[model samples]
Structures are given as C-alpha cells and as structure tokens.
Target: MIIDILAALFIVAGSFFMLVASLGVFRMPDLLTRMHATTKSGVLGAGLIMCGVMLFFVDSGVTLKALAVMAFTTLTSPIAAHAIGRAGYFIGVPLWDKTVKDELHGRYDEETHVLRSPEHMQDKQDQP
Candidate 1:
C-alpha cells in the first residue's frame, strides 16, 4: 500500500516535470535555452519516472533494467544536448536578442576549431 502511494507520487511528479520540459521547448526563445530545459528537466522527469517504475516492480530483473535505462538517460541526455548546441553554434544559428554576452566571441577559430580565451589570444598576439 505504501509502495503504491510512493510510486504514484513519483509518477505524478515525473509527469508534471516532463510536461514543463515540453512547454519549455516551445516557450524558450533560443535553441540553447530550449536545449537546457529539455535536457535538464527531461532527464529529471525520466529518472523520476524510472524510479517510480522500479519501485512498483519488485522483480530484480525489472528493477535492474529500469536502473540501466535511467543510467543511460542520465549519461546521454546532457552530452546530446551539448552536441546539438555546439553544432547549432558552429552552423551560425543566431542567438536570441538581449543576450548579455558572448564569451566565445573572438575566441573560436572556425578553420582550426579552437577556442582561445583572452589570455591565450594575448599570448598568441605577443608571439609575433
């Protein structure tokens, strides 16, 4: 009885967070922002849902599978988001207006695919 109650709570929470993540994808202005929302909340929601399912299932095999899937989701979601964001950036997708700052500005060299911060840039400039 208690397990069922706990599982229900987690499932509801997971569903709510997943819903929020979906809404964020639609509402956020930029790809990076949307990626952040989807990756963070999406992983969290999926993790919670997996936890609920694991709790609901007492069988060891089922629990192990759920855990494995949760682990995979946790590991992959952020990396996937990062790859997507970086690809978007390198492809020249415009950032949203009112962006406070671009730390990558003047730092990245497209040809070499290198990122150098101010100190590195200064050092290179002084070398010649």
Candidate 2:
C-alpha cells in the first residue's frame, strides 16, 4: 500500500515538473534560458517518472530498463542542451534585452572557433 502511494506521488510530482518545463519553453524570453529550464526540470521530471515506474513494476527486467533510461536521460539531457545553446549563440541568437552580463563576450574567437578562459588569456599575456 505504501509503495503504491509513493509511486503515485512520484508520478504526480514528475508530471508537474514536466508541465513546468513545457511552460518554460514557451514563456522564457531567449534560447539559452529556455534550454536551461527544460534541461533541469525535464531531466528531473524524467528521472522521477522512471523512479515511479521502477517502483510500480515488480519485474527485474522492468527495473533495469527504467534504471538504464533514467541514467541515459540524466547524462544526456544537460549535455545536449548545452550543445544546442552554444550552437544557438554561435549563430548569433540574441539574448534577452534585460540580460545583465555576457561572460563570453571577449572569450570566444570567431576565426578559430575557440573559447579561451580568463586563466588562458593571462598565461598568453605573461608568455609574451
């Protein structure tokens, strides 16, 4: 009885987070922010849903599959979101007007397509 209740709770919570993620994608002002919202909430939602599934199922095979899916979702979601956001930025997607800072402003080289860190820039200056 307790297990069933817990599973139901997890599913409800996961569904809520997934709904929030969907809303975020539509409501966020820019590509990066949208990706950020979806990546975090979507991964959590998927994990939670998988957890619920694992709990509800009595079979070892279902548990293993759920675990594998959860692992894959957790690992890939953020990486894929980051790559997509980076590509969007590289293609000159504009940030929201209210954005306060652009840390990547001078760090990325268009010609070489390389992003240099503050430490790397300091080292280059010291070398010369």
Point to the candidate with the largest TM-score: 1
Tens digits of per-residue lDDT, candidate 2, 51-116, equal 899888868999999999999999999999999999998889999999999988888899999999
Model 1 bad stretches (over 4 Å): 117-119
Q: State each model's CA lDDT, in order.
A: 0.91, 0.93
Question: Candidate 1 — what's its lDDT?
Answer: 0.91
Output the TM-score of candidate 2. 0.91
Please give the lDDT score at residue 104 for candidate 2: 85
Find the candidate with the highest lDDT and give its number.
2
lDDT of 2 at 15: 92
Tens-digit lDDT track for model 1 on 1-128? 99999988889899988998999999999999999999989999998998899889888998999899889999999999999998898889989997899777778899999877799898989995
TM per prediction: 0.92, 0.91
